[model samples]
Target: MISMSPLLRLALLALVASITGWLGGRCRADVGDFAPCLPVFYRCWPPKGLAGTPICQRFGNQYRFATMYSRQRRSPWFSGYLYTVPTGRRPEPQLAYAEADGNMVPFPPGPLDQKVLDSQAVEPDYINSTYSRGHLNPSLHHRDHEDRTSTFTLTNAVPQKIGSNDGPWEVLEQTVNRTLGEYCLGEAYVVTGVIPYQKDERWLRDHRVAVPEYLWTAYCCPDYNNSLPKELREAFPTYAAIGRNDPNSTEEIVPVNQTAKTQFRGYDVRRMTLDTLETYLKDRFTTAVSVFYERCSGS
Candidate 1:
């Protein structure tokens, strides 16, 4: 190894710091806020009255989705994106992880950084745990391989029970995919989030990540096939639903289906109007929670 003079070493260190700072700025510009991803939101307006750090999910040098992350909970408040008609089968998820670069979360096929493991959930957070790393923005909603993989980041996930993650909630995601794929003529914007318990918030891996009490999802389809099916008439424009993540929880919000399959029982999902969803949200957070502006009036 070659040793430089003390003065030269100090000058090199300053130059490296300046370059790192500039790169961080550039990374934020690309994947820090919703400004670069307004098209993902309905009417270019995201949900209001929620507090969290925004992360633009990028993969392979492209923006895939937007997630509002909570540093305290080490999870996402919600993930908003435009629906795409899927063309291929779902990608295999292995721990379904990502590497974080500043505010950007990228799903590269490589080992995760130790710094990322320090801040968010790692493979061990869910290993042997009762909860799974449930995705807020399910890969079923996107068409591109990269877009689908971009959602694997832990920041966009919540600690959801296995039954809900792979059972009824999975059905809900598939149903939405079929509905949006067929009836939605234009863009279908979706926002999926979680609801915490009133008194006791569950945590995973010794409080490293919080487990949600419920998982809620809402979609805004500004324009759709006018020949809508009668059963889906009330579902046009905007619709919302909530699913139970914990079976032992109360049945006020999402009632448990006692007669469900052995594995999927107690993880029932309830469909409701957007207003009703917001009402529950307001009740929990004690403030207004709007998923879409003016109920997705604009196309």
Candidate 2:
């Protein structure tokens, strides 16, 4: 170590303070209400309302971040997929926006052209023995034409269950949408997906594999009904989540349900700070949000 005179030491202190101040300013400027993350997820600005809603389009590999809710409301199957709905169903674009890529591949082929084969009429040949033509993302959550159609793709699908898809699981999806739409006020960014099959998992057939043993979700309400009366918050608490529910399920499947309020596959519901939400999205959706703006144009 070197010793310095009192006056020299004072000068060094001043220099250090100046450098610290400059760095703080740079950090604040570089991070203005938004940040980025990859691998697990991504983050963008707070979602907007119908009027001038922000379009955080998910494109490229990040498209996979769009969660799968239910492939078909009528069928008992659910899975995961990568797709995008118009940021807003408005006649025109919001003109100002930001986005982050979610995990998965990019270059999404847009919503599934129902014409590829009538989803209502017949299941396609692609519905092979290995997998069921499951809907990764549920169609009910989508309020617009594009969102509904985008959900029909083979990629936005997974092998799920008739019981889960058609029974309790389906009820859960609808209940979530209604709860959010009513409480959050039109459109909640709900990303739902599956856990996929493990080697130990049994298959319905040699081909039709067992769907996700559980579902995972992370919801954020950065600006949840700021205008609502404070007292009503409990009736409409803006934050919640769960891991898995072996509770109330068949005794063979979920054994701990007799005393528990709900089963826990991995239910971890709690309010998240803005910073946490950003980190969550960035970690979940690794690619950028690519807004799909057009209707099906090709055959």
Candidate with best lDDT = 1
Candidate number with greatest TM-score: 1
Please report how far candidate 1 places residue 179 from its true position, in Å: 0.7
Structural similarity to truth (TM-score) of each candidate: 0.84, 0.40
**Candidate 1 colliding pairs:** none
TM-score of 2: 0.40
Q: Looking at model 2, which ten-residue stretch has the lowest summed lDDT?
A: 290-299
> What are the runs in model 2 whose C-alpha is more than 4 Å off?
1-42, 45-134, 185-187, 196-199, 203-210, 226-299
Q: List per-prediction Cα lDDT, in the order shown.
A: 0.82, 0.36
Q: After superposition, how far is residue 73 of candidate 1 from its true place, in Å?
A: 0.6
